[model samples]
Target chain A: MRDTYQEQLDELASSLAGMCDDVARAMRNATRSLLDADLQLAEQVISEDMKIDDVRASAEHQAFGLLALQAPVATDLRVVIAAIHGAGDIERMGDLALHVAQAARRRHPQSVVPDEIKPYFTEMGTVGVALAEKAGRVIRSRDLEAAVELEADDDAMDDLHKHMFTVLMDSNWTHGVSAAVDVALLARFYERYADHAVAVARRIVYVVTGQMPGPLAV
Target chain B: MRDTYQEQLDELASSLAGMCDDVARAMRNATRSLLDADLQLAEQVISEDMKIDDVRASAEHQAFGLLALQAPVATDLRVVIAAIHGAGDIERMGDLALHVAQAARRRHPQSVVPDEIKPYFTEMGTVGVALAEKAGRVIRSRDLEAAVELEADDDAMDDLHKHMFTVLMDSNWTHGVSAAVDVALLARFYERYADHAVAVARRIVYVVTGQMPGPLAV
Candidate 1:
């Protein structure tokens, strides 16, 4: 019974790490759909988000079962609770990616991102996916160093988001109000995606150190 | 010992309901700050956000203690876990309010909302605070019917959000790209604030029914 319970706990962690991968892939494809105006890819990302939601539900159920039946204490209890909270954060990351995809689909054949701004968004997507992948590694390994590095990577995403704003607000901006609105919101989606990834890393840090990371940098 | 555990559980519920009030007040002040272009009020909302954060930390600690020390099961277990989740949702609501207040501050003296669009933001704020207060009532009373009503109120907020977009996208829109960006982000903040309140109501429903609410309504 003891061995099986321990296995269940470990399995919960693996499930959450898998969720990170799901959101990462969702974000990568969502970004592609946005930049290339690929309606099919955008639709695929939107439809597949349910898979991520199902993973979260199952993981939370597993964590709740561990807490109720196993009555884990101390570090074990923290792990169970962290899994529940971490799953919520990861599921939200999927939703943000879905929003990005929905933005792509809303504009349809007309690409949402302009040519000059495309590089910044491309970098944001790359950084965003990399953050999600690193968050998965942090969950699986419980490597505190990796968690710290993940927060630093989130700063790069923040920079990209800010740069996007600079390009929008510049007097020379020729994209007009509709395109600017789309770009502002798209920037927010990518920035929020990185924020959730950082939040997931913070949960890992809390589980390992018994302390939540210092308040979010921004 | 059993009686003390029960009291702890009851206190946890009160704490979460209190968190709902905190966020309600924050949103009210944030909206006021935004509408009036009052730097002092905006600063107050921004600085006082820490109070909400501290409330979350303490409530989570209380819930965690009950889970670990009491090993509550059945509805008792759900109450503790839901308190944990509810606190998180309420805290995010506070953060969203802070974001709104910050937008007002950034645009200082110059009102963020043009006179024509002020009515939409005003209604959004009123609806947002009502939802938070309703969420608190749902937490205290476990009234599932009230939770359903809260979801409907969110639809009103959604309509307001949609209306704002229409106004911005209209060909007659003359606010320029910067103002459009500001209005877009501010609208998003209020919409998300209502969404979090809805999430808190859903957590209460889950605690009562032993099931998560259906997927969010867009």
Candidate 2:
């Protein structure tokens, strides 16, 4: 019975890791759609959100079942709890991608952000993809060192977010109120995405090291 | 052994509830100081934040200990997780209050907001205080009904936040760019405080119902 349960748990973890990859792809596609003003791609990201939600629910159910039936302890308990928390984080990331997609739909053919701001969006997209990939790696390997590095990556995203705001405040951009609102909301979505990624990293650190990193360390 | 663990859990819950009260008071005091331009009161709020942080840490440690030692299942496990999430939310709420205090200090004797916008600030303060208070009640009672109603209050806050932005966009309040930045940040702080409060309410619902509320319900 113990061996069977262990096999089922491993299968559940593999399924969840696959879902994380899809979520990361959805985020990258959503960001690309926003930057390139691709309404069809944005709509694709928005419509596929239900699949992310379904996957999250299934992952959560598996985690809960493991906890209830197997009565996992110590490291096993952490793994199950982390899976549950990570699934929620990935779901929220999907919602953020949908937000970007909705913004794309609202702007239609033209990007709300001008050409100059493209680099920041690109950097943010890269960070989002990296964070998602790292989350999967940590889940599979329980790699504490990689998790620690992911925290720094989250901080880099924060710095980029601040830079995005500075650009919004600069006199160079004259898109006026709509542009400002779009930038503010976009910054919010990106910041929140990074925050959730940090949360997943934190859970990984806790699972491996049995301690949460200091805020400044992240 | 079971009885001893249950008693310890009860004690931990009581301590967490007390911590919530302190958090609620801190938020109210901080926002009142901001509205009234009371620098001394603002400083007091800042000073008390460390105490809130300490209590939050203790509550989290106690919850983790309960989970590790007792190996609680179902409702008991939910309560422990809910407490951890709740403490984190309260800590963030305290941080937002401190942000309001810092903004107040920046304004000093003169208010950043014009007289015409005082009504908006007043409404925000009133809503902010009510939200904090409701969080305290929910923490104490674990009342899902009250938690559901609290989301409606947050909707009212969202409406006020939107109105604030519309007012800022109007040419009549022309207080220069710096003041505009200050007002925008102030609006964001209040809006985010309400958001955290809604999160706390959502956690309460999760603890009671064993499922997350739908987006529309929130």
Shift of residue A4 alpha carbon in model 2, Å? 3.5
Model 1: per-residue Cα lDDT over B59-123, one tens digit each: 99998899888899989999998898899999999999999999999999999999888888889
Against the true structure, whose DockQ is highest?
1
Task: Give TM-scores for every candidate, taking all chains together and pairing residue i with residue i.
Answer: 0.99, 0.86
lDDT at residue B42 of model 1 (Cα atoms):
96
Where does model 1 exceed 4 Å of error?
none
User: On residues A1-218, what C-alpha lDDT tens digit does candidate 1 reach at each position?
Assistant: 99999999999999999999999999999999999999999999999999999999999899889988999988899899889899999999999999999999999999998999999889999999999999999999999999989888988988888888898999999989999999999999999999999989888899999999888854
TM-score of chain A of each: 0.98, 0.94
Error of 1 at A89 (Å): 0.6
Candidate 2 per-residue lDDT over residues B1-218, each given as its tens digit: 98998887777667666766776677777777777888898899888888878787788778767766777888777777667767777777777778777878778897767667767877887887788788778877888889998889998888998898787677675555545665666777788778878878887788788997886321
lDDT top scorer: 1
